[model samples]
Target: MGEAIGQTIPLGVGVALSPLPVVAVVLMLGSRRGRSNGPAFLIGWLLGLVVVGSVALLVAGALGPTDEGEPAAWVSWVKLALGVLALLLAGRTWRDRPTGGHRPELPSWMRTVDGFTAGKALGLGAGLSGVNPKNLMLTLAAGAVIAQTGIPAGEQAVALGVFVLIGALGPGVPVVGYLALGERAERMLGELQTWMVRHNAAIMTVVVLVIGAKLIGDAVAGLAA
Candidate 1:
């Protein structure tokens, strides 16, 4: 459980650093209905993660009882595939990384964010967490790590819970700050948004590469044994 949790922390951090979701939450906070929309989005985000993690755990458990007190061989292969996917994503991220102080472009839908209500915001948040390409893959990878562990179901759930909370931190901080500090959060959130846009790709490249290599090594060891 400990090793599996350790493996997922980086993945959680990577998910947190995702700029699109953070930016969306920030923009929602800047709107008139922010009080409702922000929290709703956050709730949706957490729920989406919970659903994904739960599904992964159920599937892993249903595959059959294990005698080795560890994940079956197939889980390692899934991890290996995930690792290769991560490396490919990292390469793409590196190539597309912003340069010369330029920031990445925001999604077109972001232009209409202020017009969104709580329900739409909730759906958006859920989609970003469970459907967005980068976040979806990372969350699934985290789920895979948790599912592969030989820990009890309760412990697996706890590990996944921790991953979701940590993963949501990047998007949650701004909302919390805005609620706590009121007017003072704007400048901070803005600066954070800018910084995230500038550094997101670089951070993802390093994180994905390291996690990818680690997954490959773990898979090799598992298969060899």
Candidate 2:
């Protein structure tokens, strides 16, 4: 379990630091129905992470992710593939970064956040956390890492729970603050949102590149072993 946690911490951080979701949550918090929508979105985000991570763990377990206390070849292969995909995503993000003082464009759905029902917020949260390419890949990789450790099922659940908790911190922190600090949080969160939006592409590029390199390194080490 310790080994699995160590292996997955970076991947979990990758998911937790995702800028867009944080921005979305901030937007929701500032909306008319913020009191309902904020927590609803958070719940959906947590559910999405749990579902995706559980599925990856189950699939990897079925594939016999470990052999003789070492990762099976397939685990390394999957890591390699995921690493390559991350690099490609990094390149794309870099290409799309705003330049020459132009403002970055957020997703069109973000504009509709002000009018969203709790249900719509929930669905949007799920889609962003589970379906976004970068987050999905990181969560999948974290689950695969946990599975490759050959821990008992209970330990795997604990490790995944830890991952989810960490991942939730991205949006969770703001929501908690909004609930606790009420309007006091608005200014701080607004500043944070602006900074995140302006630097989103650069942040993603660096983060995805680092994780991609790490995954590839782990894969190579496993393969070499």
User: Per-prediction RMSD in angstroms?
Assistant: 1.9, 0.9
TM-scores, one per candidate: 0.90, 0.98
Error of 2 at 34 (Å): 0.4
User: What's the alpha carbon RMSD for model 2?
Assistant: 0.9
User: Candidate 2's residue-wise lDDT over 59-147, tens digit each?
Assistant: 98877655477778988888999999999999999997989999999999899999999999999889888999998999999988898
Per-model lDDT: 0.81, 0.93
Instruction: After superposing candidate 1 on the true structure, give the runs of residues whose Cα lies further than 4 Å from its correct spot.
Output: 1-4
For candidate 1, what is the lDDT? Answer: 0.81
